[model samples]
Target: MNEDEILARIRDIFQDNFGIEPSKVTPEAHLYEDLDLDSIDAVDLAIKLQEMTGRRIKPEEFKTVRTVGDVIGAVESLLAA
Candidate 1:
């Protein structure tokens, strides 16, 4: 999927999983600082991402994700691969 599509999916995932509004989940929004996601939330997000992409989200692969855009980029890269 393209970046925009990936972002939309991310927004949906966050909203459905954590009740975050799409309007608040901007590209620059920090997962921890802005979205208030803790370590458990991050792990949940990884599971959701893996389900969405139909791929395994290794712990190492998820370590670099810190922002909404970063998640989108990661998903995009996975889709591309």
Candidate 2:
């Protein structure tokens, strides 16, 4: 899928799983600082993304995911793979 589609899915995941407002989930939004997500929340996000993509996410692949844009890029790469 495209980046916009991946972003939409990320927004949905953030909203449904983390109770975050969709409007707050933007490309530049930091997962921890902006979204107030903790490390456990990061793990939860990874699990949720795995469920959505039906693919296992490597820890290394997610290591650099700090922003919503990074998450979108990761999901896009996973989907493409």
Candidate 3:
């Protein structure tokens, strides 16, 4: 899938899993500070991303993620590989 598609999917995941409104999920939106996701929520998101991509999401891979765009980029990279 393309970047836009990946972003759209992540947007959906945010809404479905976190109860975040669609309008709140933007490229610059921070997962923790902005989206109110705690560490546990971050783990849940990683698992969901793994499920979506059918790939293992390394804990290290998620360490650098902070924004909604970060998740999209990571998932896109894995999908590309």
Candidate 2's C-alpha runs over 4 A off are none
> Cα RMSD (Å) between model 1 and the true structure?
0.8
lDDT of 3: 0.91
Name model 3 segments beyond 4 Å from true: none
Worst ten in a row by lDDT for model 2: 1-10
- All models: lDDT? 0.89, 0.93, 0.91
lDDT of 2 by residue, 1-79 (tens): 7888888988999999999999999999999999999999999999999999999999988989999999988888888
What pairs collide in candidate 1? none
- A best-first ranking of the candidates according to their TM-score comes to 2, 3, 1
What TM-score fits each model?
A: 0.94, 0.95, 0.95
Look at candidate 2 and tell me the lDDT of residue 44: 97
User: Each model's number of backbone clashes?
Assistant: 0, 0, 0
Q: Candidate 3 — worst ten consecutive residues by lDDT sum?
A: 2-11
Better of 1 and 2 by TM-score: 2
Please give the ranking of all candidate structures by lDDT, highest first, separated by commas: 2, 3, 1
